[model samples]
Target: MQRSTPRLTRILACAAVPVMLVLAGCSSDSGSDAGKGSGSSSSASQDQQGGQKPATVAPAKYTKLPNPCKSVSTKTIEKLVPATKSKAGTSGKSSDITSRGSCSWNGLDDNGVKGSQYRWFDVSFLRYDSETSLGVSGQKRAENNYAKEISKAQATDGAKNVKTSPAKGVGEAGTAIRYELKKTGEDFSYATIVTRTDNVVITLTYNGTGYAGAKSPDSADLMESAVAAAKEAVASVGVANS
Candidate 1:
């Protein structure tokens, strides 16, 4: 039984601002909390053993990702984000919704497994401004909304128990609230969520595992670290000012 955070709401009227207009703030962490594992870390060394160039860094065609987890690292993100294969060769993959002050990572399927790989770490970042009372109120509402989501997800069939904690000293933004959802009912999987909010930025993340295999997923801690890294990456980009 995980304790819930207070609800967050927004009050300000969302102004139409360019995504790059605001001076965005970002943060990161590369500590033991990242939970790096053998399979989830920099396997470049291993790639060479198997006779590969460690794969080229793919060209980053920067699309205006509304829900980009700017605070994490590409390396870390690459580990947590659901890969194309994670969907079992499905077409209509999960949908992402993003706005000036809000971002959401939705459409997660419990059965989105790939062979023995039935687990994935989904990640998302929601950026919003607490401009007006309405916006501010609405932004605050998210805290409660997320808390409730974790509560519900924990109580779900596969979720065994849930734990919510304050992600303190992990970034340079607002208070960060993290949720760890463990799997129950013979399913060995878990998920984590990290939310950061201040006057200028309100971001959230959904990182977990639903991959298949008789064993549970590895690298829960590393997944959490990646979320922190993503925050740092976004801060490097700065906010868009309009």
Candidate 2:
């Protein structure tokens, strides 16, 4: 009986070994499949993210703008504003000169008994950059703002006898606006020239009034001066970028 018991015990142990081996094999297969599934999910996430890309737009023609104070020639400034207070011009406040800039000259020429002539000239520049995220080209932006400038000039408060006409040979496109206004109990005449050259827009304003007995400046003369100054300002943009 004792010899038969030993043989039975050894047989049971051998049978248990096979069951343990089967359990280990099942565990190994499950682990491998789970790893493969995780790998596939990660690869798919990366592929989806990589598919999204930013849209492209046309590049801007002008990257930088010329200095507003130096954009015009001394001869032009002297002719426009005689006895000017500052020949170098007074620069307007600008946080970003590359994007926007302005310069102005003003003078009151006292003629003693003949009264005084007050003249003022202002020139401003605006440059646009291509926006890839918004998908807007610089030239398109300039064109849109050019229209807005015209509207703004026409809507001046207290302006009378306002007129608009094409400004020939100034830029790619140009407009001349003339108007009259009453201020400080005096009659004033004004002329504004708005021109767009590529991605940059130039606006020139010339205004004058007679103090005492002097005659108010003519609208036609102001428009001519504004147009000529605008042409020079537009040319400076090309020189700056070059």
How well does candidate 1 match the true structure in TM-score terms? 0.40
Task: State the lDDT of candidate 2 residue by residue for 1-242, as single tens digits.
Answer: 98799767765655667777645443443787868888999999998898766777889999999999999999999999998999999999999999999999999999999999999999999999988789899998999999999899999999999999999999999999999999999999999999999889899999999999999988898888888899899999999999
Best-matching candidate per lDDT: 2
Give the Cα RMSD of candidate 1.
Answer: 31.7
lDDT of each: 0.40, 0.92
88 Cα displacement, candidate 1 (Å): 17
Off by over 4 Å in 2: 1-55
Alpha-carbon error at 131 in model 1, in Å? 6.2
Task: Please write out the lDDT profile of model 1 over residues 1-242, one tens digit for every residue.
Answer: 13322211111111234444322211113334344653455576666676543333322122133324333444554444444332222122334433332322223334545433333434444433333433344345445544554455445553444554555553333333333454543344344544433212333444444444434445456346545654654453244321
